[model samples]
Structures are given as C-alpha cells and as structure tokens.
Target: MPEHEAGGSLATPAHEVRDFLRRRREQIAQRWADEPLFRTVFTASRDEAVEAGKAVVDALARVADAQQVEDPDAAGFSAVREQLARMGAARSRAGLSNTQVSSELAALWPPAENLLVAESDQASPEELRAWSTTLSVLLGTLRLVAMQTALSETQSLIDRQRLQLLEVATPVIKLWDGIVAVPLIGTLDSARSQVVMETLLNAVVDQHARFAILDITGVPTVDSLVAQHLMKTVAAARLMGAECVVSGIRPAIAQTMVHLGLDLGTVKTRASLADALGHCLHELGTNIVNAAPDGAGRR
Candidate 1:
C-alpha cells in the first residue's frame, strides 16, 4: 500500500522501493536462496539460505527507508555485515573469484525485478523507471559492502595463518629430563621472536625444564635485533626459574658479535647442541666415562 495512483502524484523512490521490498520479501528470499552466494553457503538446508536472504532483504528495505541506499556505512547494513563477510569468505574458499561472486549476486536482481514490475502496473513509466534506478543503486551499495567486508575477512585469515606458521617453525623440543631446546632455523623478526619467546616459556613450564637451550646452528646471520631478542628470551626464561644456554654460535657469527661490540657475558654460550647438552648433563651430575676395549666401560 504505497499510495500508487495512475493519475495522481506518486511516492518518492525511497518510499516506493521500501514498500516493494516489504511486499516481495518472501519472493526475493526464495529466489536468492538458489543463487550461488546463498546456495553454496547453506548447503545443509534450503531453509537456511531462505532465512539469510530474508535478513539481507530486510536490511535493504531499512536502507531504502532511510534514503541511504548508496551509503555502505548505513546503520541498516550493520546487521548483515558479518553474514555478508562470511558469504564472501565462503565463496573465496570455494575458488570463486570476486567477479564470479559479483555475477552470482547480480543474478538475484531478476527475481526481484519481476516482482517490482508486477507491482508497478499502475505506476507511470517515469515513476517505474525511478523506482528501478533506485533499486539498482541500492544493490550496487550492497555489492560494495560485501566486497569490503570480504577483503577484511581475507586479511584476518592471512594473519591467523601466518601466526600458525610461525608457531610451527619455532618448535620447542624436550631434549632430556629438565632440559628443553628451540632449534632456531630462520630469519627472526619481531613477530616470530615474540612467538619464540611464548613457545619457549610455555615449554619450560610444561616440561619443568631447568635448562633452556636456544640453538641457532641453522641461522645464517645475527644482528643487533636478533641479539636483543635472544637476550630478552633468556631474561624471560631466568624469570621463570630456568637458566638459558645460547648454543650454535659458529666461528663467523662469533667474530661478527665481537666486532659489533655485542656482549653476551650474562648468557651461557656453547659452540654446538651436543656441547650444550653435555654441559646440562654435567650440571645435573650425569657422567660419561671413556670406554675401554672388550666392553669393560659398563658401570
């Protein structure tokens, strides 16, 4: 009941579109449920897709009522922003490109268009054209909102994956009773260094480790930043009642540390992992005596 008269003044485009959406909400939802965007996401049941479509239709109607169809930040979009973002992410995971997703969304208009046309029988051609144009603009804004939210979701996923990779790369191994080690093997940045610190600390507490080893035998280089991170990690371990050993300082890296005036006197240093383990064993009162011939070395 949008007060449409063939010979009288008609309602504004916003009013007309809002009324159209309210009247045809069910039809639009039924049609959109079959589109790729909703169909693939709600495969558990067609009813779920229909419900999601109704939510989006309700949001659009609110936007039209507010005369903010072109505004992506309209209050109406807040309710469905997360839903749209998830849809975008799902489509991306399904290997559909942005253009393909957009095309799928475009398919939703025809059903709504048919409904609009049917309702506009009494509308003059001019009024009908205005209503159609308004609806298109509203749809265009919906596309913008969906794409923006999708990009944000993608970035969030990348950040999470990167953190997971860092955790995998900086694994803490329990080498012996009361002894744990993290064998460093890559370029250490602030982020990865933070991960290393957290992972090492967790291992020390979980393993009740007395000696924590940071073996950098596989590291290619060590600069001031890397040294600083090492020192911080060592300090954190000491605070947790575990003494830290810095091992795998090759000859070249040792010379570089000396030339750069880096002083690591506070940290226990060893040339290799085996040497570090030997030191830990010695501290723990374990001994390995030289073996004589004829297997006489058994204690």
Candidate 2:
C-alpha cells in the first residue's frame, strides 16, 4: 500500500498465486534443494535434503494460502511464523551461522518467482511489475522474521549456558543430614558472592540444614572485599536458620587475617572440610567409629 502503484489494483496475493505454488511445488522443492547455499547450510543427505526442501515449499503454500505476505502477524499467517521460528532455531542448533541463513533465504526467491511467473496469466508489464514488487516485499518481510527469530533463539541458548555456568560455579552439596557444604574456589567477586549466598541459603532451606560449611580451600587470597562477601554469606545463612562454619583456613590466609585485624566474629572456623564435617557430625549427635581397626566401614 505504498505510493508506487502504476494504474493497477493494489491487492493481496490472489488465489492464483497459491495455485501456481501448488502446481509447481515439486519443481520449487527440487530447485530449493539444489541451491548451493541451501545444501551447504542444511547439510542433509540427498533424499532427505530434497524432502526438507519440499517441507519449505509446504510452508510457503500456507503463507500463500493465508495471503498475509505483507502482514506477518495476521492470524492466518501465525502458522507460517511458527514454521519460520522453528526453522530458525533448528538451523541455529545445527551450527549454521546467521550469514548462511540470510544467504539461503535470499536464494529461495529466484526459484519461487520463476515458478509463479511461468504459471501466472499476468503477461502485461503492469501485471509483471505488480507481481515482482509484491514478491520482493514479501521476501523482505520473510527475511526480517526469519533473522529476528534466529537471533532470539541464539540469545536464549546463550542465556541458558550462562545460567548453567552460574549453577556449576556455586554448587551446594549435602554432606549429611542437617549439614550442607558450599565449596568456594578462586576469586570472590560481587556477582559470584551473590550466587553463593543464594545457593547456600536455598540449600539450607531445602535440606533443613542446621549447619552450612563455606569451604575456601582453593581461594587464592583474601581482601577486605572478600571478607565482607564471606561475612554477608554467613549473615544470610544465619537468617535462613543455619549456622555458617567457614573452613580451609590455610596458614597463609590465617596470618593474613590476623595481620589485617579481620575479625570473623562469632562465626565458627575450621582448617579442613574433613574437620568441618566431623565437627558438624559431632554436633548433630552422630559419630564415626573404627570397625575392628581394619578396612571395615564405620558402624
């Protein structure tokens, strides 16, 4: 509905367009499969690739059926939008780059137009112009939806990976009944500290844990910021009804703490995870005894 009309009716794609697509559907499928870029991006076996190409033609038929070429959000075009979104996400998981998707989408226009032009009764210049201009606009709309859907799906994948890494970095392990351990490694930044606090507090609530051990054995060094983060974690755990016991106080770390006058206050401290777990077990009225002083397990 632009100002470029040339004395012809400006209307949607007529039923004849759908008929053209249906009559030459097989030819469109074969040509789409044969496109070099399409073959490269889809990377399927010969028959399967052609079949996949045919599936694309099927989607195009639906779009033609709906006649919402210029209006992607139209109710009738919802199926086509879903098809495009699924294709975009599938291609992204297949390791196809954004550029390859664009190239293949552009490649589809030629074969589709050829089929339509051959079967169309619009032999006049005005008719030809209308068909060409309309098809061009439709292709542009399709490209926009396809690319945006692919980008959105890719961003979702990235966000999922980001969350997985966050979970992995702040794992909470249940050492025993009423005892959970959160092992800290490397540097303590504000972001990781927050993740740690949330994970520990959640574990305490989930397990009804009375004592949560925060082990910093692999921590490289301790700064005022690191101390503040640890204190915050302890405070948060206490609020969740779980006492915090910090372990893995290496000799160097102990010396640094004393030199800096870093008072951990009334928070319990231990030298190793084994010691912390032993203390936790002892406080919980659970004890481990040697069996026959041999390799037998504790009773």
Candidate 3:
C-alpha cells in the first residue's frame, strides 16, 4: 500500500497498527513486566514471557485488521478469543489469582496507548483514533475471556475436591473374615448417601464380604430425610448379595424414628458399631475372646 506521504502517516489503520506493533513490541513487554503483578511473578520463564508478549502483539495486530469487518464476539475474532481463553486458563493453573490476572491485564492498556502515541505519532488523526478504539475493544474482549476462564477453572477445581472428599468420607473397611463396615460419621445427605451406597456395594464385591454394617453413630440427627438415606444404602448393599446392619441409634434418634413411623422393617439395628461387628462374627459361628498367655493359663 502507498504511504500518506504528507506527514509520513501510514496508508491505513491496519498498516499503522502493524507498524507500531513491530517497532515497539519490546517496550510493551517491558512495561508489563514493570507492573507489580509481573514484578513479583507467578509467571512462566523469561523466554516464555517474551514469546507470549510477541504472540499478544500479533493477536492485537490481527484485531485491528478485523475491527471493521467483525466484532470481538463474531466469527472473525473467534481464533484470537480462543487464544486468549487458553492464556487465561494457563495463567490460573500457574497459580495466578484473579487479582493478579486482572492487574496484569489492566496494566496492558496504558503501555498499548503509549505505544501508539510514541511510535505512531505521525499517523493521520482519524487512523490513530480508529486504531486506539480497536485496541481497546480487543483488550476488553480479552479481559472478559479471562474472567470466564477463571470461573470455569475454579468450578473444575471445586468439583475435583468434592470428589476427593467423597472418596475419603465413605470408606468400607473389612472388619472380619467376611464382614465389612461402612462407619459413616456425618449427617447423611442424598449426595453422600449415593457415595456410601457405591462404596459399600463395591467393597462387598471386591472383598467377598458376607455382611456389611451401616454404622451411623456419628450422625447428629435422624430426621426422615436421613432415615431415607440409610435405607437406600442398606438396599444397595442387599442388592449386591451382602446383608446390611444399621448401627449407632442414639436414644433421641430412636425416639425420632419411632415418632416418624419409619418402617425400617426387618433391617437389623445395633446400638453401636462394636455390637454390629460382634453380631457379624456370631452369624459366622465364631466369637472373639482374648487368648491367655501360654505360661499364665488358668493361674
């Protein structure tokens, strides 16, 4: 394209943007590094940072070229938008908090404006204005993309933690030769109960246990809701061919269950976890007793 030739302005806005990006890319990155967020780091290596800065400049140049042809949300800008999203997620996973990411992104606007002012000073007034506006819109789009990535990644992390807690909370221990006990401590909600059911059933199959105990001694209350959860877990265990015994019925909880007319019919109940395990051994025709020492027998 031909030059403006009057005041040494570029022929078009795109040309002007490309010229500034090529000339002042280093200054933009240096400015970003001076920001407090980058100065302290949660950043990648120096080479990675420099490469990322160059990619950003290239992305912005593309944005300027497409400004008149498309908006940030439109198909024309999808590639750059996706690139920014990846960048956002990468930043989050690298241990940058939302505040740090925001600070760095917000810090970008000033250096960008400075780049245009210092490097493109001789551009036509209209072309300069268009370029600035285009950059602002693209930067704003990137900011929004970053926020969305943060939200999505945060939610993912929460889900993983919840799954981990479920695995830890519901453990089925093999208590005897053919007995397993699932000693539930907290209040049993529907979600937790599902985990309990799955754990109990899997243990029954895996351990070849003949009896399973659903001990709820640590449960704080026995409302109808909680009673239902217990019943579901028991049913799941029986379906897997192992008998289930409910344990840890406090006086108050028993009273509540009776008052609520919960027909836990035919499901054996024990006052404590020890009672449940003892009963399991009894059904197997064996009872545990402390063995006297060889020398002190009958003394």
Best TM-score among the predictions, by candidate number = 3
lDDT tens digits, residue span 1-299, model 3: 33322221333555556566667878776665665434444255665555556666666666555543224343434454555556666666678878778767877888788777776678676666777765565566656655765677679989999888787888888898889998887878888889888888888989999899988888898888888888887887888788999998989989988999997887899999899989988998887887666656655
Candidate 2 all-Cα RMSD: 6.8
| TM-score: model 2 vs. ground truth | 0.59
Q: What's the true lDDT of residue 123 in model 2?
A: 66
Model 1 spans > 4 angstroms off:
1-11, 39-51, 78-86, 110-129, 152-179, 185-187, 198-210, 217-223, 236-243, 249-269, 279-287, 296-299
lDDT of 1 by residue, 62-174 (tens): 98988888798999999999999888878888999988888887877778888898888988777787788778878888998988888787788899998778968988999
Give candidate 2's whole-model lDDT: 0.76
For model 3, the stretches where C-alpha displacement exceeds 4 angstroms are 1-23, 42-48, 64-97, 119-130, 185-192, 206-208, 218-226, 250-263, 284-299
Q: State residue 25's C-alpha deviation in candidate 3, in Å.
A: 3.1
What Cα-based lDDT does every candidate model obtain? 0.88, 0.76, 0.72
Over 4 Å off in model 2, which ranges? 1-9, 12-16, 37-51, 74-95, 117-122, 173-181, 185-195, 202-232, 240-299
Residue 165, model 1: Cα distance from true site in angstroms: 5.5
Candidate 1 C-alpha error for residue 159, in Å: 5.4
Better model by TM-score: candidate 1 vs candidate 2: 1
Candidate achieving higher lDDT, 2 or 3: 2
How far residue 266's Cα lies from its native spot in candidate 3, in Å, is 3.8
